[model samples]
Target: MKKINLKTTIIILSLIIISILFINNLRINKADNLSKAIVLKTNNSNVISSGVTNIGHQILTVKVLEGGHTDSKLKASNHFTGTAEIDNYYQEGDEILISIKEKQGKVTAVKAVDLYRQHWELLLFGLFVLILILYAGYTGLRALFSFVASVYIIWNILIPGLLAGQNPLLLSSFVLVLLTGIIIFSIAGFTRKGLAALAGTLSGLFITIVITIVFGNNMGLRGMTAPFSQTLLFSGHIDLNMKHIFYASIIIGASGAAMDIAMDIAASMEEIKLKKPDIEMKELIQSGFNVGRAVIGTMTTTLLLAYSGGYLTLLMLFVSKNTSLRRIINFKMVSAEILRTLTGSIGLVLVAPITALFAGWIYCSDFFIITWLKDLKSHLKFLRP
Candidate 1:
């Protein structure tokens, strides 16, 4: 006669969804030609440096260790592009990605494309999981599940929708809401705390989208400012609306940071409510506000640092050129980034109060008796009589 826990049921359902996504992705993205191989011998006699460029080729004797070409040995060629960044010089015993050309049930040719880096990546990921689990125990497992769920949802749902030329606004909106629910609920469970975080996140995302549209439309900024945007435009999707996608990017990027703020406030207020059931609505709201204030300063800076960190080289290039502040801000690339950083930070700032208010109304007020609110109300009434 044991009652099944609702939280456990939700987690199980989420796991099922993730599994489906994983399997479907494998089916759809199956690349039979790409396989892992290990270098057995290297003939680098052709490789040489010529006028600030690497002019040469690498011939590698390799054995296929994975995929359809397992246990096959072949001579693979690694051509040098003369650019340091594009070249991959392999030593003996280096694992690499090989593209196998098969014709009529026989391997025609094999070429080394890049390094087979999944081994090290998996090792690093395992280390992260071990540290997380050791530090936080069960909560860490929940966090890891949420992380994987987010990745699968993005890879399976969002990217495909965008590539299919679906309305960026609609797709982004749907994805934002979906991710918010999955991430917050997976961690906090189906509780008022999760509701508060979800509501606050969506509300802030709306603001971000509106601000992005208003500013993005009039900023005289083209969608080409986005990295690799030119390549995409000429990829036969000329009719695709890059401007709207740019706008979507702003909101989508801000949402994750905003959700963190919302969840922090909501969780803090929930703990407060549990510890002091007799607390007034105003007092609880104020406490939530206090918690928000404590975190907001550092969070905004963290957001700025995160966005800026990616373009450090570009910023240094600007600085090295003695680019005037006036001209620097006027640059389209810099301007677009300015808007993105500020808009995202604004969303973070707004979600704090929004989450606190929602947590207050949901936890302290009697008018909101959805689900567990009734049980909470048996002893604690948030409304002032």
Candidate 2:
């Protein structure tokens, strides 16, 4: 067993302490109602004009008249006209400020000075990163860097390109290839292993893109099936072709699995070479195939599980409604997911053999073409001379 070095121990301890401190600071600075403000405005008209009001709820109505001098003064009104419960302590024309909460463009809650919810996800995220650094060490740091790069590329390049009316299928395909290169090479470094992974990942991703485009169109998977897609239309900001987005998403989502399979096969081949440098071409290729067979089974299932998990609630709703299998499967989102997951799985299967053949030919001694040609020439020249 390798002994723990002093540097590693200190780094681990420092990471733990930093994680605790950051978490504690996040808890201390959480939301409080003291930061809120309540204001009131008055309309002096004797005729009380009421907007839409629902029973069993309270409303705070503020009237701002045109060309009113009160705008500069931040006016507070003591006069309000509304029905209140008998037990509610308020005099007629008394100064009172009411709080209103709007949900989906309608008032839902009327409470005073409620504390805004503090989102703790960022703090939890920090702790998660710290934990990863402390435990996994160098590998964790590389994974983190890759994750950040993925986010940056997606947000800065892919999204902007989509919004600019670039062809979704083409842009997404290009982005996926770029991301695969960055992610695999950054994690694995520049080596034969990295090259093998890059080749496998690119081949698989291309296959996935082709499959998604063909099947997604045939299945009539509309992009509007995704949540908030209609909202983007209503907002008047996005003039997008929805079906193209659906096709793009299929390819983009599948690229992750492609990269995983490629990396796994490449890494396994690298390990094999390190262990048995003298392994022949046939055996080395077989070794890669063997490892790929084991990986593909789980990886295919992983794609299914990941894609299906998002729609479990929708599936349950369909089941409860006694929807027929034909109808359920015909749903746009369901069909899209099926195409995405299955197409990506197919890509993974193809990538394994493709990578194995290339890696074997490149790394194995017996199959090296240049070396073989050189030796053949040397033997033939003696006979000729």
Candidate 3:
């Protein structure tokens, strides 16, 4: 009883420490220049068209919704860049993100930054949490906690380390380990199921890293194929290794799916073991392998479908252009997606077997020795007959 209590205490303390670190790492920088405002009025009479694009400055009357400038009405200007991708079209009653310039604690100027979407974002998030808790109950709640931890690790540890010019693979590997352990143990507890899942995820991810590095080098494409990667490179991070970062992204992207496969195998095997306490090691292993085989078939296809779906527009473009299969496959963007899909699928395939192997051994070890002896004696008696 004492031992159990001590173990519980240790677990609780460790969780507390991790929570503190996660909070500190995810600290948001409060910007004094930023404020939320509602677009009260917009004038488009002076707008002019340039070629196929609108190139005019929009004048707006915005009422501040936050800060000391609350309820203050100010005139704001939004210039059209003739680029639809970078511009926001605001209507009255639309909440917007804005930057305020102040002189001696008085607002002198304001500029619209973006359409404020936080209210809907929060509403959706709350609905999601509510649905998850209601459906999966405690397990869903635990999953939510893991989800939060993941956001913090990615935003804080992974992003900052990469920005600081740290070795991308190393930093990403550290992040992977942290996330794998936390996410798996948090959901599965510190039992054999969690251990098996963690070990399998790390091992599979390690293999993924190797495959990505080797294939990425020979692919003859810079990691700039990713959206915003080019922008990021030119945005004062010229020293960062975009290739390694891309490799890291592949691992990170595949990790969630890999964990799913591992958990499936581990959890299935764990249930099997609980039901059949005296199950032989060989039988248990075979059961795990069977479960792995079944899961991997769909899981690999699932990965492919997921990657392909995300690039549906690109695929549509290829179809519309009637591009040859060879040419389509050779395109850098298509090739990158292929690599990501195949590499992730390959890792997931391995994770199932690896997790099954470990879970079978760990779960069966305690009972297997005795079970094996009894089987051996019974077989000997049969031989004597």
Tens-digit lDDT track for model 2 on 194-278?
7678887787777777777788777777778776789787887467988888778877777787788878888888889999888
Distance (Å) between predicted and true CA of 249, model 3? 0.6
Runs of candidate 3 with Cα error greater than 4 angstroms are: 1-28, 46-53, 366-385
Number of the predicted model whose TM-score against the real structure is largest: 1
Q: Give the candidates in order of TM-score, highest first.
A: 1, 3, 2
For model 3, how does the per-residue alpha-carbon lDDT over 265-366 read when each residue is reduced to its tens digit? 899988998999999878898898999999988988988898889889889999999999999999999999888989898899888888888888888775
- Candidate 2, residue 280: CA error in Å? 1.8
lDDT of 2 at 268: 88
Per lDDT, the best of the predicted structures is: 1
Where is model 1 more than 4 Å wrong at Cα?
Answer: 1-24, 44-56, 82-86, 368-385
Every candidate's lDDT? 0.84, 0.67, 0.84
- Give the Å error, residue 164, model 2: 0.9
Q: How close is candidate 2 to the true structure, as a TM-score?
A: 0.66
Cα-based TM-score, every candidate:
0.87, 0.66, 0.86
> What is the lDDT, from 0 to 100, of the residue 14 in candidate 1?
70
